[model samples]
Target: MKSTVLTRRGALKCSLAWAGAAVWTHRAPRALGFTNANARPRVAAIGTGSRWCQRATGIDGPHGSAPSFVPFGDYVAVCDVDADRLGLAVDVVQEWTGKAPDAYGDYRRVIDRNDVDVVQISTPDHWHAKIAIEAMLAGKDVYCEKPMTLTIDEGRLMCEVCRKTGRVVQIGTQQRSDESFLTALAIIRDGRIGTIKKATCAIGGGPTSPVIPQVAAPKNLDWNQWLGPAPDAGYRYLAGDNGETQSWSRCHYEFRWWYEYSGGKLTDWGAHHVDIATWAMEKGATGPTLIEPLAVKHPVPFSAGFPTDDTQYNTATEFLIKATFADGMELEIRHDGDNGILFEGTEGRLFVNRGKVAGAAVDDLANRPLPDGALRAVYKGKEPTDHFRNFFDAVVDRSEPISDVHSHHRALTTCHLAGIAARLGRTIRWSPTAEKIVDDPQAQSFVSRAPRNGFETEV
Candidate 1:
């Protein structure tokens, strides 16, 4: 594999973001094993299912999709368990790029290639950590979707591998890149809101899928590989182009509603809201010390953390989970209120969602203004740039992106703890230093699951 060198043209085009930083040297590009700077990073996308299509095609799928990787990297290959989706993605990429890219069914093959510079993992939540870790080990940078890990230990391992490999990995917690979120964090960090006492993240519940009869797996889909590390289950479908339906509680975006695939809304929207709240509170590298299930109501009965029923969506549909931090800050993560974070401070309160950032602190930003560089301070001294741009910049500069893996892991740990505590209907003690549920053996068990033999994600 030939390293791409940073071209003088590429340097000039992206020079603004690296104004004061030495982004290149006479032999730096060759030393860093990068290809010609004029050439974009070669991207191989894994998991070209519906979400991938939504990202690659800019079509709406779940949570209003965005065109991922297309704006920053060259699409060289696409991999998926579903042959149909893979073919469609190839067609879409070829149509857009005017050159058809290599397509593969197995992601392992895509990661093994030396020509690939970066890999995007938009697979189901259960598959996110494994693919990302493997990609990092293969010396490829990663742009992984949010809810970065299916379990607590997966996050720990992913962070470890990222450190070991020194790869520029960015988690897709894009709220960190949004201007409104930046404004909100700036206001909070500026102390207009006073000392933070509580943060409320009102992420909603998951939906229940209507029951459909079991059916044969679609010919284009590989049900076995799709299962991956998850327990094997029958093929299920919501609806077909011709109006046919099959039974399955989990698949596609609905995977967020199943415990086996995701941690329900606790992880789905929780990843976004909790991540923002944690950033504002400066708790990105540390998590709650105690997780108490204040009140939880689930769609199905849960014995311990496992759901007793598998017919319908089994994840918690509604609940209030409380986490107490080392600073005595109580975070209320619930299935009520608007989908956003509410910061309650000693002096004032601010509410921020995808739409707007409200309250006195945000308003005061206009009249009083944040200290110069407040926004850039939160962005790690760089100007607010596109999320993918940040990733590419870091790839070239060897700096950490705004949504680096360490902070994402901490926020994701909070979400995983909230889910575990809620499912067990018990208050669980945690040692943030140890990164484990304290004392309660049962609660500790949920920290990690036994991955199937070949699919185990280990550091």
Candidate 2:
């Protein structure tokens, strides 16, 4: 395949937060790789499903969603397991870029393209690590969605591959790019909030599914490929209690509810909130010493760390976990309270979420503004643009992305531990340095699962 160096004009999207913030470049674009200064990276989008639409369409929110996939890279190819979605994504990408991209069902096809410079993996969580590792091995950088792995071990492997490949891979925890979060971190770093003692993340709860009854797989959907490394299971669905208004299914969006495919809300929202809290605390490659499932409620029965029934959503619907860090700081993961992180320090406190940042620290920022370039310092010395734009810049600069895998792995370990504790109805002691579950071999076993033959995610 010809190495397509697609023209990506306007990749440097100047955010009002920092419109002229230090010029947003660490190095000039390589002359040979790009046709001109405005040349864009070519992208191969794998798993062109729900998230692709959510990001490409740009839904309205605290930050305007109108900017899309082009801000990160131009699509040279798109891949998905479901033929219907694959077709739709091709049309969407063609419409967005005014040129049609090649399409494929198997992601390997996308990864194998020499023309592709980046592989954007927005697949279900279970598929993240495998696809990312494979893409990296193939010399492609990665932009994977949050909750980057279905299991904790995959995170460890991701970090290893990142180091081995020396690729500037970025996780899709876009909160790191938001001004609200950047401001919150800068305030903490500036010492407005004294020594942090506790961080509470009110990530909210996941919905419980009614028993989703098995149904025939749609002809357009490749159920086997969708199952992939997960255990083979029947497709299931159920309508809302009214049997008409809404619906639930075993695949696609609802895959997060099944342990076989992904962690529940623990990893879902935990990836975002815990990541921010960890960054503020400077936990830096270390995780909690202990993860205790203070309380939990699953929609179905679980035994020996596996759900007893495969017909219903098994992830915890409501739960609270207490994690104790090496510095005596405590982090709480809970299902109740507003969806955000609350940082409590010895002298002050603050709350931050997608919508806003609140508390004494924010007010203090008025009387004492953060040191100049403080927000950039919070974001690894780069002007924090919108998430996708930051990634686009990193591809050129080859600097560590704000949401690099190492820190995300550290934060996600807490979430994965909390999830294991919830499934087992117990507490787990962990060795952050050793990266081990510590005492119980059975619990340690949950760290990684053996994928089906030929599906193993090993490097």
Candidate 3:
């Protein structure tokens, strides 16, 4: 691959070349008579978990995934380490497309298929970098879930591979395609909110768990495969009562509560709200300069930034992390307050979440509706589509979507830095330009983690 910036035109050219490859063969042809039918991208769903659906309502129902892409692409294959979930996704795709697609336990098998041109990853954060990099290297475009990388270095590697592959990639930061956030961004950028002063995202915190006893991995689940790049750990579980089950294991939904595989609420919800805060501040191109743990409370003790306990949930149960950007604009991520973003500027203040946007600035919009193209400008000259639709549009056009990896890394880096500071119980300075921690090697070490054998991520 050439070492040059992947211009939109270059991407379009590549997309065309890809389209010119062997004509696609859709068994059921659910959308064959529709637009772009001849060159409809072949999709491979890499994870079948329902969090991507549960993250928002109206996308897919509980326990199913990947239905939205049916209009734009064909599901050539589906993969998940949990066989039950894999079967669930298989049934969903089969019902939608009228054809049952092949299923696989290993993502590499899906990546190896020349027939799969687009990969949709809904896996845990630990597997995001490895699978996305492998997919891109295989000449496949990717639509990966967010907090796209488990570590800072993984984000770097993803961006490098994206540039090298010139394949259209979109992160699952759907807020970029949400009407509420878009409307708020338009109002802010239109100067109704004036020059921004500070932004705060009150993302909720993680759950503390009683010591979950080690248990044998479920028969249908491949625990080692699910752990992926994270270190080997025991499978811990506490069975549920009347279907409201809780798992303390280092797998499944519980993985988010463990620092080993995720950055807890910081990266989970912060990935969504912090990203909006960064976008609203117009600081998507860079990260924070100083990340301070104003207050932090974890369930267990920590030494050298690593959690001391693995039998129970290890993430902060309550925390307030302040990240100061280069221009002195501060963004605070907290476990309290309304679960939304508050933006305060010199002239006016505004607040936005998945639900609504409010402020004097937004109220003014009722009288003086944003200038004709304000929302479109915020959407990069396109109308905001459902996040998955946006990815499909980018795939067809061979251009970048609303939430590209570059800006996401900048946003998630703040979350990662805040996580590090909270773990170390100290403030950590950062150089966003160099993308490194400054004056503290111990804190800097959190930027990347060595992968377990066979799970290493590289360009």
C-alpha TM-scores of all predictions: 0.89, 0.89, 0.90
Once fitted onto the true fold, the runs of candidate 3 whose alpha carbons sit more than 4 angstroms away are: 1-37, 52-65, 241-246
lDDT of candidates 1 onward, in order:
0.79, 0.79, 0.81
- Candidate 3 C-alpha lDDT tens digits along 1-459: 112213322442544334223122212232233266566778888887775343222224454346577778888898989887787777777877889989999887787676787898999888888888767766678898888988888888888767766767899888899999999999988899789999999999788887888989899999988987788887888865312224346677778888888899999999999998898887888889999999999999988888887788899989998999888999999999999999999998999998899999888877899999888899989987888888877766667899999889889999999999999999999998899999999998989998877666434
Q: How accurate is candidate 2 locally (lDDT)?
A: 0.79
Q: Write the per-residue lDDT of candidate 2 for residues 1-459, one digit (tens) a residue.
A: 111111110221212122122122211232123334246677888886556674332222223221255655677898888888788777777878799989998786776565677888888888899888767766677889888898888998888878766677889899999999999999888888899999999998988776778999889888888888877788887776521224688787788888888888999999999999999999967989999999999988777988888877888989999999977999999999999999999889999999999998788767878899999899898877878777767777677888999999999999999999999999999999999999899999999988865566533
Residues 1-459, candidate 1: write the lDDT tens digits.
111112222433433223223322321342232344455678898887555565433344453222556666788898988787787788888887899999998887786686788888889999999888767765677889888999999999888877766777888888999998998898888888899999999988766656545578878878888888998888666563321113343666667778888998999999999999888888987889999888888877778678887767778878899899988998889998888899999999999998999997776767787898999987999999888788888877778999999999999999999989988889998899999888899989999988765666533
lDDT of 3 at 292: 95
Pairs with steric clashes in candidate 2: 8-40, 58-65
> In model 3, what is the error at residue 455, expressed in angstroms?
1.5
Which ten contiguous residues of candidate 3 have the minimum total lDDT? Answer: 22-31
- Candidate 3: C-alpha lDDT: 0.81
Clashes of 1: 10
What are the clashing pairs of model 1?
3-34, 3-35, 4-34, 4-35, 4-36, 5-35, 5-36, 5-37, 6-37, 7-37
Which prediction has the highest TM-score against the true structure?
3
| Model 3 TM | 0.90
Q: How many backbone clashes does candidate 2 have?
A: 2
Task: Write out the backbone clash pairs for model 3.
Answer: none
* Model 2, residue 257: C-alpha shift (Å): 0.7
